[model samples]
Target: MSALILVVDDEPDVAELFRQQFRKELRASRFDMEFAQSAPEALERVGAAEAARLILILSDVNMPGMSGIELLPRARKARPDVPVIMITAYRDSETRPKAIEAGAAGLFTKPIDFPELRGEIGRRLDAATGPQ
Candidate 1:
């Protein structure tokens, strides 16, 4: 069975972009991706039984109701074993520190480097599952 990755972003287009970028992996069944357009939806998904397959979370920092940084600690509380990586278009001085302090596993700036992100995901999944 493939591991699950949850992606949370306010923008509607972000989901399509992730699907396109991770198309090969998705086709190969290396992992499955799920999208949550808001932090509340993400939290629901995280707390659900479906989260049993969850290994990672990719969340945008600037959502309307709850920013990714704000969601970080709550998500961790819900599923401490899963790692959360924050993504932001802003990437200001305060963002990084706030994310880290809130328990983010990593942070990525927007117009994300997909290859690097993929590598990081691979590493985390590898570490989680151990040797194939």
Candidate 2:
């Protein structure tokens, strides 16, 4: 089965950019991508794919209706095993702790280095799958 990644961001451009980047950057054909523009939408996707097949979630911290911090606990409730990594333009000691406390696997700044990010994501996904 393919490893699925749910990307939640209020910015359509950013979401699409990541989608394209994932496709271009990932060597694995079994990596599937999905996107949501809001926290509620992300939650819905998580609920729908809560079964063990789903792998990871990458979300932006600042959004109109619900920030990533707000969504983290909720997502965890539905899919505790899935790791949610928060992305933001503002990365500092203050925001990082809040995200960690809220249950983020990690935090990344925007203008993300796709190659590096892909490597990290791949590691997390591999970790989720356990030993081969």
Candidate 3:
């Protein structure tokens, strides 16, 4: 089955950028894309999906209600095998450690390099679900 990635960000433009990049890659492969504007929205999506179909979650660390770190634990609990990658504008010792402690698979700074992030996502997805 194709991997499904959820790009979670508060900003519409940020989510659209991720959608475009991943969609371009998936067009040539077996994969799918989805988006949520907030952590709650992401959780709701997972709940509504009714299974662990979500393979990857790419979320912005800074959000209005709950930061990605705050949501990571819940996301992990909701879908233990699905990996969460935290994206943030601020990178520091504290934030990184907190994200890790909360169960983030990895963390990246904002103004992200989509090509490289896509590669990393591919690697993680491979590791989680196995080849293809």
What TM-score would candidate 1 get against the native?
0.95
lDDT of 3 by residue, 68-93 (tens): 77888889998887888999898677
Ranking by TM-score: 1, 2, 3
TM-scores of all models? 0.95, 0.90, 0.88
- Compute the lDDT of residue 104 as modeled in candidate 3: 91
| Model 2, span 1-132: residue lDDT tens | 667889999988986687578765445555778889999999999988847668899999999988899999999888888888999998577989999998999888987877888788779767877633
Sort order, lDDT high to low? 1, 2, 3
- Candidate 3, residue 118: Cα displacement in angstroms equals 1.5
lDDT of candidate 2 vs native? Answer: 0.84
Better of 2 and 3 by TM-score: 2
Which residue pairs does candidate 3 place in steric collision?
A: none
Off by over 4 Å in 3: 50-52
